[model samples]
Target: MDSSSPDETAPAADQTDRLILEVARTELGLGANGGADGDLVVLDDATGALTRAALDALEGTQHRVVVQETSVQHALALAEEHRGALGEGRLLIAGLEDAPADLATLLAGRSVHLALARLPKALAALEVRASSLARAGVPALIAGGRVKHMTRSQNEVLAEVYDEVHATRGLGKSRALVARTARDDLRELPPRSSEVEIAVRGMRTAVTLSGIGSVFGGASADAGSLLLLDALDQAISAGEIEDTTRSDGADGESDGAPEEARAATPGEGSPAVLSARSVIDLGSGNGLLAAYLRSALPAARLLATDDDLDAVASTRATLESLAADAATSDGAVGTEESVGVDAGGRPGEARVLWEASLAGQAADSADLVLLNPPFHDGAAIDATLVQGLLDAVARVLRPGGQLWFVHNSHLRYRHELESRIGSVQQRARDRRFTVLQATRS
Candidate 1:
């Protein structure tokens, strides 16, 4: 639902965003799409609100704006704010996760005034996305906060695709970059480096994770995930898993699938005779847990989901590399094949979804779910996302499912987890992180 009327931005518009608009307005002499039947496209995946705020600044003009988002929370917020423009076709939305392949097709030959807000994901992903925008033949793109947000690597990547990429002086902590793109060589991008691969182990199996700078804790597996993985393995091996699978959460299958069919039979099972029959990695960054799960429980079907574009792409890359590694190693052959890598780089046969929140996950589905809920929003330790994820976990988990959650030690999530999930217990804890296990009632 649109939050704002035809001519207004949402009431929650902050000062920093409005500041960005002022800079854009001053530098670009902002106006409606000037070309015949042209509409400006706001390519924002970083903050998600930049497009809305920019549109708000340009609201009274004759410009038509299209907002494409992979994050569901942001799309809904902007859509709600601009309900009138959406109904009249003056504004539109596209989901990057839903149709990543269609990005080029959507932007082809478009006379777009693109606003690339400071990317919240990795620079490698930013490069890929920027190249896509350049390939679409956008005439001009005004990047928000280029001075403060962009690193030298980021600037170089942007400069490679966009001609005359120049920056403005800082506007109180905010800055801008206006680029008149020279987009003929979009397919000619330089290769990304693979120098910073981090190695982590769950029990005896060691996996290499290569992540970009924007990923939490870089490419390395954090201590929390490692500890939780061990505890989960022990629980599954002991048959402590709850059996409340309603439906396949990743596919939105009806809540009527038989639980016995997906479970591991006691002594009757043959070559694939194991427990933890199904698993999901919530916010599976670099797919560390998924890889670990595949190594530990080879027969389990794995599904990895994330809201961040970089995390999704990086996780796919990580899993694919793991699959290739498994094929070469003496032991990982079955593990690799069982994980089921699709051609599009997803972990399973299901569509690699980019959900804004965990709201619509399959209810009562899964034997085990592993998560390390992120609490930091910028510099602040925000618990709102953690709360939301916990709620989603309760709704999606089956009667016998297990939730392995690792979070900051200081957070009061134990009570909340116990309330939503059935039984909560501390598995491990250190100064910075804590490992928790909660079984669904």
Candidate 2:
């Protein structure tokens, strides 16, 4: 987290943030005497600028403001910058998936009078926020988003939980959807479920995965992931990568994988078997890739990490569902303690962390890393976003480790991988996607 002062960054709040603040203060009387008598929750302030200004604006007021950010990086930055800003209030690092329960628990008897939020990209994310605010018994919510991103469906989603939903006039191409009167009948949005078939050790296996609305692709496997999976399957079939999950023609069990299938030993001028002992799913969005890895390499230690709290929680749920489905089909599966999965929460073997780009991981720890880096930084197309991930992967990969990377064809990440990690091989290429395998030298 940066050590810069929050006050210094408050001015950096963009047009959207400024308009949201103006609407809240002028239209809603947010900082006035008669308004916001109860609790106020601020959501999705990425830079902590909006949050910092809100805290200062509400100073000396009876209304206690709660600051919540889904991104751990943003949350930590805000916490570090504003140590004493929340005198009687609370700063929470949570997402729509966990924020409601967390906020409810923290504010035991308190009811939220108002919620100010920057709108999320996905309708499912919007639905989650609306449902969460409704559950908190919020009287009014002023949600702002860029005019280009706003849609009629968003209003419909909010209307499901709120009695009235209407958009305010556009200001500088940004607008706010003011929703009032929380509906009496509101239920939390359940995780969406979908079945996807992926090639596992040359076998077509169908797995059911679930993800909250906030998670990317919302439980459905994306095309890029499918391409990467196909590349992995091709490698295993060609004997370049050992297939530990191969069935023995009788039961689904491998009894015990051969010694060659259990280790990745690369000698001088000898072909290396990519039997990874430890694996990482970088930017594990909905845990789709992580869930696949768990079933494909049950003995390997897996770590699924994401920057968003929603992704972390969604990955947890997806893996838990995988464990449950596996247990029912092939007897019981014990929870592995090596990965730090709680014994009570579904049987899982992957340890999930909420961190941005392998921040705390030690050097030379992972044997294999699967990366499908997100190209977008909010609304902007930032190709440099993957640079940080490539750097982290270079540090964390061992001498004989491998990185399976997938990206858009136009991105041409081959040179990037060659320079960052080691020798890069184009395993698969289609019209839109390219899957590459890079070895750590």
Best by lDDT: 2
Give residue 281's lDDT in candidate 2 (0 to 100).
Answer: 91
Per-candidate alpha-carbon RMSD to the true structure: 7.3, 5.5
Cα lDDT of candidate 2 equals 0.72
Q: Each candidate: what lDDT?
A: 0.58, 0.72
lDDT of 2 by residue, 1-441 (tens): 222244564437777887877888877787677546676788878656667656655556565657666676776666666656533334433432233323444444666767888998889878876787788787888889899988899999999999998888878989998999999987767778888888887888887777775787788899999999888877766766543343222232334755333335653586766755568898988888887778777656678888876777677778877777777444222322121222122222467777778876778777689999998877787899999999999998877678999998888788889999999999999998999999888
Q: Number of clashing residue pairs in every model?
A: 14, 0
What TM-score does each of the candidates earn? 0.70, 0.82
Candidate 1 lDDT by residue in tens digits, 108-172: 65566655455434676667667767787766666654345666566677788887777666666
Q: How many backbone clashes does candidate 2 have?
A: 0
Clashing residue pairs in candidate 2 (N, C-alpha, C atoms within 3 angstroms): none
Worst 10 residues of 1 by lDDT: 334-343
